[model samples]
Target: MTTLTPAFFAQFDQDRLTAADQAHYMHGYHVFDEHREQGALNIAAAEGAYIYDTAGNRYLDAVGGMWCTNIGLGREEMAQAIADQVRQLAYSNPFSDMANVTAIELCEKLASLAPGDLDHVFLTTGGSTAVDTAYRLIQFYQNSRGKPAKKHVIARHGAYHGSTYLTMSIGNKAADRAPEFDFLRDKIHHVSCPHPYRAPEGMSEADFLDFLVAEFEDKILSLGAERVAAFFAEPIMGSGGVIIPPRGYHKRMWEVCQLHDVLYVSDEVVTSFGRLGKFFASEELFGVQPDIITTAKGLTSGYLPLGACIFSERIWQVIGEPGKGRCFTHGFTYSGHPVSCASALKNIEIIERENLLAHVEDVGAYLEQRLQTLAGLPLVGDVRCQRLMACVEFVADKRSKALFPEALNIGEKIHRRAQAKGLLVRPIVHLNVMSPALTITHAQVDEIVETLRSCILETAAELQRSGQYAGH
Candidate 1:
């Protein structure tokens, strides 16, 4: 993990590149010692639904470039759009009232696509900043409206907001809120995850829904209606093991938030831009309109860094009142970077041109159906999916819903095997996740399922032989 280099850097040599990566390239949350000898996976090139390593091995990218590549990869038109924008107007100051053409255009496009009166957009570098900005905007809104006491925020257990201090503080994930790292402990609260699969064994789905709604209302009242500002949630929790909430969960939670004057902030970083067969999932899929929607990832299809904190007209009337001489006093150097905005504009155009939204509805269903086949496997505890996004939870005992020991690194093992067998999946704890490009074909879906099946079976056999997994 040395950050110092002695001599001149070599860019072309593979071994030299690996050495440089080990010496200085710092990646997030990676086990440095574990990959100290072998180095990292060197991604060299990417095409539609596939990525190639430095050594030229190809993988059907099942994780969609970390759940962002909705339009797939290596689109020449996307490249042309980016290049054209760069050549036309590469950079501009998004400070104060100054703006660029692409930035203005992208905002208008996003406003049109987003549901409800989410007409105002605050652009950011990525999802993390979008969320961070949204919270700050909430703070501004609360303070301006003369309710400074309504500062505390409510997020759910097992939520992933961002790596920023405030976002991490509110997010209850263990790694984000680790003991060593500092987080705002007092400003955040958590409710139970709305996971139907992990709900009380005897509780029916309807009862579970009622219980969640009651619990959410109870959390708000317990915090005091005047003290809570907002409830932050993902439509389907993405990083917390792709936990899809119970039916009617989003609408009910929004209702409760509405009753208590708490704003609903939907974190649709992974769900927006065609991951769930909709441009946005909150209103269209779940029937709830959030006050603030934090979005990124698929915004530019992972091509350029871009994200937005889209706010409703109701919020704008308070904080954006022109007559009041209001100053929101928040922004970034690359808040509305012209090149990034141009890329996003092109990405949306491509999605429309290809009719990715309709295609996702058709193919996403097929993917969910195909993944159901994995439930028959012994290692699988649950096969949960929300349209194209999916996860396979590993288990030691199927009937009892027992998890395998963490030491086994079961998800990583399966991920490595699947990658070798020509598909890539995301490994989060004991869960193997998939979120392929929206352009993925039926054949690609079949390839993913079959490769995963073989990989899981092989992994099980190897674990059994090593006495790590008991067949009984």
Candidate 2:
């Protein structure tokens, strides 16, 4: 498919823009004016895996718009589907006894596509809400079964669930969560994540997995497993530095959850809908049949905000059973919004019809092979990938695997340099995570790798020149 081109370049000066933006806008994942003051590269438009800036600069979108837009941009079919739905029934509340046609149809489609007994869905506005809703569902399910003490949620360190109060507790990235308010006390517990690269020296993958599982078991026991509601995890940690767990990690965790009879909540928010070469990442990668699944991001491929907490029949029977004044006791005004549903229906169709999963497997393999070239670089410590998702961790000493000090901001500098060179990739703390559109071509991968190579080299040179590249 041919990518789109803008008619003309946008011309806007940043000095004048910062005053107003700083006064009004609150940016997420950014230091706001401190970063904006340096410059905000205004994106004029986007199509396929490329975005054009106000200055007419064209860049490869390596991160796929925060790792969401899986099908790429300029998808007329999805946009038109949304438009059609809006015209047909733009707004509707799925509260209590109400629902639109699109919502109903999308639910059926999702049920057919989801794995195992995950046939029922509770829709939400986006990923965070879906996560929040899952927590509520787990609690509600336990209550229905006459267990009121199962209110605590167990998550893992280095996991990024969401930013909502409940989800922030489940999320492990301390930086993502604000200082706890009085209301947030005693809400969540965390276990060590299984990242062999960050594991203790001489620890094998099996040892790491065993250690994490033991830690999880200890935490659950200490917290009183009867008081624990669910265990939340991403198939491969996304925003939390893209830390992929060792093999058999999830298998062991799933066994532990089963042993304790705790609900297993897999956060497929960043890995669902062909993003990981499957409809769901947990089943495809780890053989997990979660009691509930929290997902968003690729559901509508960024065309519209949509998320869902998919429950197994057992969970649905507990939550969705018909009774007077008895339901999940949760929903959003925009839950199962007609337009969003239509967009998702169309997006999923595109993914299947185009065989995007197979494409992801192919292009994803290409991406991994190309990325391995980066492993030997002076600043590279480890490279990770499981399909469309990939990341490179930077360290000051590869032999010792010692990270560059946070003060150096090596990752952010590399990100900025890549942006200057017309490449858009995300730097998560000390790693660069790339989640390009599943439809990206081989040429696009080459462009991304070449740009990244240049940026790393330049950043290394600058640091060395400044005496910051503390060597072996």
Candidate 3:
């Protein structure tokens, strides 16, 4: 393990951080005061696939900093690019036909790389804003066609779009919506998730795919096709446990969307920029061309905040019509901030110049194979992987596939164990997820597998000792 010297802490004034200050800081997605005594993991620095905390402890970031840091951490080239852009032009307004050179160039590059008539780009601050933009655009397009009733959206269970009100409404995680966000828009409806592991017993994969498609079509019909605005989906569900869909599922769902005149929106916030070894997973991996695609995270490798909603020519023609008297009237102050655009341009150049996509294709397969070997463990119920994204689900009985009681917090226990062993993985309920940097190597893969192996073994032993597990 690599440790930083005391001199490193001097540069950042680490002496100022106290337990009282930490207690006052409210962290997102975590229970307040849950770790008040221990304090949060104060990340000080990072390089490549490894991160160092304030105590100089090194850890392998298997979750890729919330599944965004694709190229890797601490790339000097990316930093220089951002600095150079800020020195030149720090910010610019994207509205009123005003444009910046960097943003213009980035849009052109993205359009050239995108598939099938997806040429128009609308920039935003992050994934949630991109999704919010897409939803509004879908409604605008329908209203432009004099079909104001087509405002309802169709989303699948276990799918995560974003955190904004509209995006959160489209998301299907029941826990995310309960008493707190119960006031989210009701126009969003959810269909079944095409999760192979959760499929009913005696059902073949082909049958399951058909059933999921039917469920989607039935929901549209039940809602009345004229009232449905769009269908939003992730190529692979991310925060909802990395659920990979059955084969040919997305294409069939696209066909249903076409039949019902519902726009298909692909949420590639976590899967784009080589996560699936492709610039965009919609056409390259899923074999479907969506009407709109919302992307963030990997666009700049999480070095800077940036998001974009790419539109198909078919939708653009209506919104871009010259006869329209009113403006779109929606934008963010940081919408095409030149610094973020510059960083994204440099990030893409590095990914292309390094041929990281090819690297991921080769290394990702090894990761999947190594993770699959854990299925022999008594607590490993299922291991699913596609490219660099993966999930390991824990259960009480492997044969019966019964999950441990929620109170056990099996995933969190495994996560803590792995972190102690110099590895970090995201715990989503009963699953441990991995979406490491695209630059991770075979040797690093070995470290991850070994650490995960030990963590699972320790967790199983703890459970058995506490009478929570009854396995050999």
Candidate 4:
């Protein structure tokens, strides 16, 4: 064991975090120690759609704090709600029929806001747990209905559910799961991704939609519908490059699920809570009533971690039946954490009181229109948007839509350029952006687009200088 001095512990403090200290103590997703040694931008404060680093540099948070922060940051109401809850009841055990008032209230509110018969809620700490819990519940439901062999899960390629073992197995992001996670459970199957931008060469949008639907049905048939437990999907794929499925794609998938008796699970972790101008995007935006909906991130607007798996009455009727002598046998210690629930309650109130959903709907259209302007850039292969969530795919050839060499790290280059220009956008492989906060205004949208344009131009120039840009 290494001996630690008081000074060494002090170095780990946020206020005293230095480049060396960060390299020693902190590591983030897909980041190496060398990158951390170069130093990280320490955010000291945030308000509305912007965040200020410790260096006093203000940045327009284009990704909305990992697509959470739906109502934006630095809300006094959210802070007060959390503080008040902490003082009154900071923790509670949600097991054994025990519950907290705030948790109950949040559940009730969520149930009322959810679509169709999805009125039952099981709270968790965040998106991953919500997804894990849903997967477990699906198994339990299957077993309860005398179908224990129905243990297989079907997910789409390029879908991002979460990070837990089960969720990661369900997700099809090859980069997210690699060398270390090579032994994932074999119960999950991945179908073709329904991305219009990368559709087959000669396939029309309608033909692509039909192809995707047929692929889903064929996968179900291959797995033997009775052996497949559920189909997991994100309303609009978040971390898997914000992939937006073609119109009516979700409805067709849901129909396949219904015909096969396989449960349809909507993983709306990023799209819920006004991100897509709706409480839940499954039924409202996609015209599909999922048997279960998993949500997090925006639930508390990143003020606190909270997630929920809402069950439809159709399934709840079987699983929640009285005297069944069945226990869920799964729950997180912080499943119904009081402070998180309180924060979520306040967050929901703010979204409703301010009519932020409508605001997102109006501004989202303008944002999409503004984003279309980026299509004029040579590097921009595709510009796709659904409400406030959008993505810009960069390619070496706009006509051929060929991706840049992976070694070039072109997406990271543009991300760094944008960050230096006081803007933050997510880099999903070959450049993809998601600005989900409802607080982003049309003016901010213009700023984001302009910053992206400059960053793309700078990246292209650098690529050209390096002889990496092949003229189409």
- The candidate maximizing lDDT is 3
> Residue pairs in steric clash, candidate 3?
none
1-472: candidate 1 lDDT, tens digit per residue: 1111222122236787789899889888767686697688888778889887766668999999889999988888888988999899999999987999999999999999999899999999999999999999999999988999999889988899988888877777753555667778786899888888889999999999999999889888888999999999999888888898888899989989889999999999999999999999999999999999999999999999999999999999998767788887889999999999999999999999999999999999999999999998969989998778999999888877878877777899999899888889999768998899999999999999999999999999998989887863
Per-prediction TM-score: 0.96, 0.95, 0.97, 0.95
Residue-level lDDT tens digits of model 2 in 67-86: 89899988777778878888
Off by over 4 Å in 1: 1-12
Indicate which candidate wins on TM-score. 3
| lDDT per residue as tens, model 4, 1-472 | 1223444334344546664556465544746644554667767668788887655568899889988988888877777889999999999899987999999999999999999889899999999999998998998899888899999998988888888777887898867867766536688888899899899999999999999889889988988987998999998988888789888999999999999998999999998998889988989889999999999999999988899999989888888789988888898899999999999999999999999999998999999899999998968888988888999989999888988888777788899888999999988779768765798888899999899999888888877888889655
Query: Each candidate's lDDT (Cα)?
Result: 0.89, 0.84, 0.90, 0.86
Question: After TM-score superposition, what is the CA distance of residue 339 in candidate 3 from its true location, in Å?
Answer: 0.1
Candidate numbers sorted by lDDT from highest down: 3, 1, 4, 2
lDDT of 3 by residue, 1-472 (tens): 1336877755654445646447577776655555666667788889999998776788999999989999998887888899899999998888888999999999999999889999999999999999999999998899988899999998988888988767888898865765655546578888887889999998999999999999999999999999999999999999888899999999999999999999999999999999999999999898999999999999999999999999999998887788778578899999999999999999999999999999999999999999999989979999999989999999999878898887788998999999998999998779999999999999999999989999999989988999999994
Q: List the residue pairs that clash in candidate 1.
A: none
Each candidate structure's count of clashing pairs: 0, 0, 0, 0
Give candidate 2 misplaced runs (Cα > 4 Å). Answer: 1-7, 10-19, 177-183, 320-325
Error of 3 at 359 (Å): 0.5
